[model samples]
Target: MLLQMKKKVLFILISVSFYCGLSQSREVDSLKLSLTNSKIHDTIKIKNCLILAGKYGGFSLDSLKKYTLDAIDLSKKNNDYLLDGGYYFMGVYYSEIGEINKAKESYKKALPLVDSISNKKKFGQILSAYANLLSETNELDEKIAYYTRALKIMESIGDQSKIAFTQYNISNVYRLTGVDTLAIDYLQRALISAEASGQKSLKGHILNNLTIFALKNKDLEKANTYLIESENICKETKLNLLCFHTFLQKGRYLDELKKTLEAENAFLTALKNAKKRGAPQDIMLAYTYLGKHYEEAGHAKKAIQNFEKAQEQDPANAERIMSPFSYMSWSRAERELGNYKKSNEYLLKHVKIMDSLNSEKNKKSLAIAEAKYQTVKKDKEIANQQLELKDKASEIQKKKTQNNYMLGTIVFLTIASILLVFLFKQRQKRKNQELLTLKREFQIKTLESLIEGEEKERFRIAKELHDGVNGDLSAIKYKLSSLLEMNNKVIKEAITMIDDSCKQVRAISHNLVPPSLEKFDLVEAADAYCANLNELNPSIEITFQHLGDVVDMSKKAEVNSFRIIQELVTNSLKHADASNINVQISNRNNLIQMTIEDDGKGFDKTNIESSGIGLSNVQSRIDYLQATVDLISNEAGTSYTIEINKETLNGN
Candidate 1:
């Protein structure tokens, strides 16, 4: 019965994989038919060629290269500005095939024409592709430079999808280098841009990678959350490859969590799915994982069987499928099964593969050294040629100088006489303007420094009150509790007074610096404050709504924004005597928009002086953030709106 259940589950997974593959194949066929049947223009044909190349990239290297080359030739023949795009695709294909030198050359050819390309979107795409190739070569610095350049171009063009794609690639590189924090940061940025651009496929990819990163970080809960989201997206998009990988990752996570039975079932399902799709590499990986599980469980015979199956499914280029580890696993299983000879044989094979890999690495190093030598030699030749040209030019310049000296001296004197007088006046004006500007700058800086110092002191005092004085008072309270056993009225009264004082001190400390503001973003901090308000005043309902994506901002902006919202909410709860308070924070056109509304008796706009220190603090924070504020108050209710530009907060 258990076997039957396992077979049924495997069958279902295989069926799903098959359906997704069929759907994708049908789409590709439809696109091909459209290209063949239509009388497409040259530009359209070139685009179709590029699309076909990308579609074939994973399965057929020959076809991919052929189409990419055709696109380049056709674009050149037509004098189309998308020639750079064609070269970009060609570079991608070469890089995919491990032709690093050729790929780099193709990328170099494309970059010069990127700015000249009529389509800025395509130019940005090309730059991103080039950067990806650079990443594969281990040229991380150059890769980042190209990615940054691509980001600027994409942003300038307002191509959100390309921007997301570029960010995703950057995150991948960071992840590869083990920079988990930066990787997550870029991935989050990519997610925002992808969702905003309605690029569900790209968003799904980012989510899937994020799941892997979270798993690496031992954040199982976050990993599972990201995995579920990615799975949903893959199912919706019918992305068979991503679905296969997601199942594998899920199985690995389950295995790590010690859910052995569930992990085994997942691995079996992944194996079936990969077999259904004819993905040899994934099939081998699934079998390898299953073998490892069995080996760990002391099922030597079962482990050996699975390892053999993995070996059978492994591709010709087994190194690409982690062949060394697979071989080691096989050797271990064989040794456990008492097959000494076979274990020794597999071990030898593993060593041989490693040695061969090392040899290949050495050869690659030698090739790189030779290439560098040739480059240096060429540079020297170019330098010598430039020196010759410079010497000849210098001789000609000397002759020209002699001939023009008498005439030039007179002309120079006349021009200098007029220029000196004009420059003197311009200098006087510039100096006066500079002095005024410097004075204003000094005043602004001084004010900013004072505000910063004040905040720092407030934080210091708050920490001392909480961690020092408050701790001592708590200890004293504990001691007083012991005295309570005596049942003395005087002791009880003293304890009550101490408790009240402690409460007041705690409140004062919190007022100095809200703990939430220090730890959370503006939106989260505000939500926390509102929750606290609801707890204190059950009659008043405070609702918080965050729309769109909220990215991380500068600390100053976050702190000031939290303070402004806190002050507004407090006023509404205490002075306004409001029954319902609504707060909305949203991102629009790269600006943060915050709105607070309360249903309560409002004051007149003309009575600004009537408002207390809370309103003044709000204005002060707004000025610090360089944000715009609008307030509307009436007999019925009051509403406050603030627009904050993030660039201004970042000191752009």
Candidate 2:
């Protein structure tokens, strides 16, 4: 309620509102013209489509989606490299339209593409945009991590505009999370960058944010200074959307300064601008803030009326354009007006949303953890039942034979004939048992060969993708860069696609045959894997330790053992909800030992041997190495200990 008075995240609010004015700009017309020209290169058309889509920002989401899709289709048809922006913009559209989950997917699709591209600006924008997703609120660390990464990229590229916004984003997160000191510190840094960038709308937004921070710190004088400056900037720039937000903050600052009539006018102005801008979120916030202004002024009936208008804008969870503060304030207004039922309803909604935001939901972390728990239980139960059924059937068959033998013994006239028949039956049973054993061994050998062949094929494909296809793509990118105008953003964009393709190819190739395993020994590979995993998941820490030095196993054995450790560690990360994981290995004489442990709420181990629950492949690798594993899991954590005898593997 304190720092959160920054109130409601409207990420669709374009920082520099002239971008909003782009809808009517001649540039949009020019881009559209190029897109329709038959003589234009398909690559140029695709770039135009993306630019046109961006130009549609703050104007028509449908047009944005249309152009983005067009770009994606044309890129795929032309085998062009322009796809990340398509996905990124699609993510933005999804987020704006309240498809949070789909937005996340789109963001993920774009994230892997941005890593190899040379445009650090887009990289920063993508990260900053994704961090604004509502689903990211609970992942505090990851949210900051994204902003931090974006900030670094912006700094590297020396893009003051991007840097300012990134700093502002980081500040907003801190403000919402209640680190007021750090929030204000970063906000000040953002103001400096905004000044350096000399963008009026950007400067306005930063000053308005500072006004909120200043008011929160009870510095009315500072708040007054920022509010006035922000208002002047927004008015001068004719930024309607920016005016709505800046005016809203000005209203709050005036309210804090106890300027009743002035505060009322500011709120009304914000509402008028929001209507003109035609964004539901802006309208909703304006109404909510006006309602709060009236409520604090003791106009209970008027407060309820404005609150109702805000609720109308929302339309049964159609959008979350108002903050918990708005809801709570509305609830209080209802209570003051003697509407107990409405008051409680609003209050409950406020509390529920707050709880969800405060929860520790790190993207897919919670779902993976719960799914693993249930899956492991279901698999184990099924496996145990199958084993029991087999045992019962075996017992029944043994009883049937014993009964028949007793009856034959009783009917036998000579004891010697009974003895000869029993002996012959025993000899036949031994031969059958031998045949079954041989069949089982043959099946295991066949499986081993299949797995070995699969690995070899994977290695071959990895080499081809990395050395052949990837290399060729890189060469083309270099050639294009040399031939095209260096100042052309379109060429940079095409290079973006090539870079994305090259990265995608390398990723697939790595998955087929992990470069770490091929390039290093098991110990070094384990360390590299841990490092990579840690990088992928900023929410979790994975540590690797190797102790002792001894001999090397056969290649097959070493690989299988490496895989076992890999599988165990990855499983812990995905399913254990572990904050900390440790992988330790020791080799002495001919014995090698490994222990993978995690500080997570460990799963039930009942009937663990019955079903694999996706651990079947892990078990197969373990079996191949002739290794023994001891698995212990409890509330404290899960630990996997494995031992391998190098001599035994080498001899085999």
Candidate 3:
């Protein structure tokens, strides 16, 4: 496709040259001749060709300059939003020629037109071009502002491909401003977005830029990854441009890695590739890099040769290109070649250009400031007018002749008296309603407390019957069998039956209420339960620790706390298959802290919330006591921490 474009461009140049030779008048004839070029027929194509021609052609400049104005006028006549784009391109060309005022004027004209365009994708693209033009001179803030606007628009439109380009541009601005980490973030985002969009071409470009950003950030791993991705994309696309870029990037990465031989090879490949493509700009860059590589390797003479080759390829580029960045390579190369005077000269020029770029940027900033001042002034005026209009309306109402002061006073007093009586009645009604609500709440709490007390009493009685009476019954059966001598098989069987019945009854009662927990305090209860648990599961190990002096808690708090602990221990012993458990109790700053940790097969919290009945009961009981419980469980283990305010426990 590029070959086809080259053929077409050649044909147009030849035709225009032929026509100009035949015409008597050169200027008018050259203009007329240019009209026949396909680049002149389509405004979009013409704008693109003008910019491209500026980079390559000598004679194309005059024609491109003329057609740029023509394109702007045509766009306006056609009501095309692209007129803004044309104006931006013209600004770029003028900047290239160092015509600051003309460039500024063109950009000013483009500004509103670009804003008026409703298409977000095109808006983003045009804004990016405008930003790039600003960045050309050292208008750092303006470049950032415009690029930010473009990025936001691209992101809003979900134009993934264009957004990647914007990200790269933002990264460049950050890098120039000495924010390497921020630059890396943007460049990485650009690479990811570009790759996700399946835009291999854009991916390659972002990858190369990201590599540079990472290198600046001193992130060799990130730089190498991006370089590899860039190289792969370049190979896939057969993009010689990207190959040249990534090779240079890899050379820098290798240099940072201290692999000088690999770095040198990469640099040589980049230089060879750039030369093969006949891209003077890229070749010059490659030569500058080679100079740096040689200088680093202690080959000063070879470094100077490479620097000279770079300068020879693009000497005029120092002035002809608006990019403040262009001088960086030249300045470094001149310095290392021991041309201190020339190096300082280039460096001063570079700095001056950068400052001028900043000044131009400041002018735009001043313009924006002026615009904001006018906007605020206009808003104030509008507000003042509105205020005056309101005052006038009030005055007009006041001017009405009716003055019924006495009548109004009488009516107002009567209304006030009636409203006072009505409000009093309403307040009385609300007070009565609140009293009724309080009574209902009190009754509910009384009923709840009574039910809870009854349940506890029943549990205590059941435990006593199981542990005390059932144990006595089993002993009695054993004593009777001993009294009968139990030599006969029938008598022995009957004695075993009685013992089994007693054991079953005791188990049932223990299930109804744990006997040890009822008889002991929280700490003793927990220790005794863990001991019983360890006896039941000999493989399990349980450790208990107590801190602070034990305070006598109310019976309700004690029962609830004991029941919760018992339920937890039972679940751990039965289902957790826990080999090691640690229970800690402490009191600090008027709060009780109980933490239970276990190296168990932890259950998923979500699954437990959905399916675990025992956990639900524990959580409900804790919530009723106004205590806080936090459970952290993963594949490795389970941890439960319960915190109870000592005040809440004491109140019970």
What does candidate 3 score on TM? 0.39
Runs of candidate 1 with Cα error greater than 4 angstroms are 1-30, 38-43, 55-83, 94-106, 116-118, 135-138, 258-265, 268-287, 297-317, 320-328, 341-652
Candidate 2 local lDDT, 1-652, one digit each (tens): 3232232233444322212333445566777788878999998787777777765554556677898899899988886466886787788777665677888798788878876457677777878878766433446556666888888888988988788887888788766655679888988898898889775666777788787777777888988888889878876866566787788888888898789999999999988987875666667778888889999999988888998898797687622446787788888989997889989999998897687656633333554355458779999999999998998899999999999899887777577778899999999999999999898678678658866987888789989999999999999999988967667888888899999898779766865677777776778777887887776677998898988995366666667777788778778867788999999989998789999999998887885555343677787777666678898999999998888887766334
Can you tell me which runs of candidate 3 are displaced by over 4 Å? 1-117, 135-141, 258-261, 272-281, 316-652
Instruction: For candidate 3, write residues 437-535 as lDDT tens digits.
Output: 798667547644864875678688787877688878878886777767637887777778887777567655764565665687778877766766666
Please write out the lDDT profile of model 1 over residues 17-102, one tens digit for every residue.
21133244446666567556557677766766666665554335566677778788888889754676667666765654446578
Lowest summed lDDT window (length 10), candidate 2:
13-22
The most accurate candidate by lDDT is 2
Higher-lDDT candidate of 1 and 2: 2
Task: Report clash pairs, candidate 1.
Answer: none
Models, CA RMSD each: 23.7, 33.9, 21.2
Q: What's the true lDDT of residue 490 in model 2?
A: 85
Best by TM-score: 2
**Which pairs of residues clash in candidate 3, taking residues 3 or more apart in a chain or in different chains?**
none
Clashing pairs in 2: 81-497
- CA lDDT, every model vs. true structure: 0.72, 0.75, 0.66
Candidate 2 residue runs with Cα over 4 Å from true position: 1-26, 33-39, 59-63, 115-117, 134-138, 318-321, 335-337, 344-652
